[model samples]
Target: MHDPGSSEHNNRIPKPLGEAFLSLLERDQRRMLRICTRLESIADGLPGSGKLRRTAREIAFLDRAFDRHMFIHEKFLFPLVRSLCDSRESVEPMLCQLEAEHATDQGLILEITAAYAGAIGSTPRAVGVPLCTLGYLLRAFFENFRRHAAWEKMLLHPVVKDQFISETPKHQHDAVLRYSIGAGRSGRWFPAVVG
Candidate 1:
């Protein structure tokens, strides 16, 4: 029942990264939830036979989405924040923690992918392994992303606005361009229908 493009679901625009990445994350998260829900439904329907191909395809798609999500956060968003945020004391540790989380995220995605593929080629009991792996990964992603977004909104954005006034004018303008380019190139993260 989640609407990926619904404005109500979109996160408020953080001045650092702009609203575009937040919108993209909202849309992508909804799409991922939809895919996971559909996969669960499909799995539920095939109780005994174990539809390997369908499960494999779903897992593959999820893997691709996770990859793009990580890339955007690590490569584009994090670097921008690091460059702009003047407080080395607070920002540095947070960025380090965020990077560590990203690594964990990648690990979880890889584990899910491997387990899902292995399950597809193995016995029925093995199917549960991937499902559980995906469930954990999804939960972790939701928790981490929500926390990260909140931190940016409440703490980071305000600091940037108040203390780092010098960057404000250029920040907003750059944020729009960066986000537009990032979103446009995120065709890999988006579903074919959205693309």
Candidate 2:
């Protein structure tokens, strides 16, 4: 129910960092949601086991994008958030919850992937799973992922935007640089995705 754009404090994220990293993460989340929508439609239209491979393929694709998505969160955003917060205890619970959800998401995807492979070239009853059952799992994965991503956008994004420390523009820039993405890491800003 929370709105990501609503900020209670006057503090603002540095334009460069916000535009380059935060906004892109949000964009990625939206992209994932679109994928979820597609997956939901696939689930709805599934008529037989023949389409289960397509569901698996789409889930596999989503898993790749999700890896990059979680990399940004675990490597950059969460660390910056922890640093900016007045008390680590306050934010730790939320961070832990997100991390836990990440694990659950990965587990579900893995199960779906394995099931897809196991069911290949086999009948639905032989695999002990009906087409409708796989469809149910696909729907569940996307729905759960949708809720998780939305929660992150609603709770975390606004916190990052408004919780930063700054007095003047110089100080703001310093703060931004200190917590900027890819700091003290490889020159590569992002992992390359081979299309």
- Per-residue lDDT, model 2, residue 14, is 51
Question: Under the 3 Å rule for N, CA and C atoms, how many clashes does model 2 have?
Answer: 0
lDDT of 1 by residue, 1-195 (tens): 988677866764545544544556457656655665655555455434234567567767867876776666666655555544445467767767767766765676676566655546565545546455545554554555556556645755555444334445465666445444442222222221111
lDDT of 2 by residue, 1-195 (tens): 755666843456556644455677778888889888877887778755336556666877978988887887787677766655667688889998998988888887776665555446344534655566567777788989989988988888877767542234554455456555433222324322111
The lDDT values for all models are 0.55, 0.68
Instruction: Assess every candidate by TM-score.
Output: 0.54, 0.72
Top-TM-score structure, candidate number: 2
What are the per-model C-alpha RMSD values against the true structure? 10.8, 9.7
Q: Model 1, poorest ten-residue lDDT window?
A: 186-195
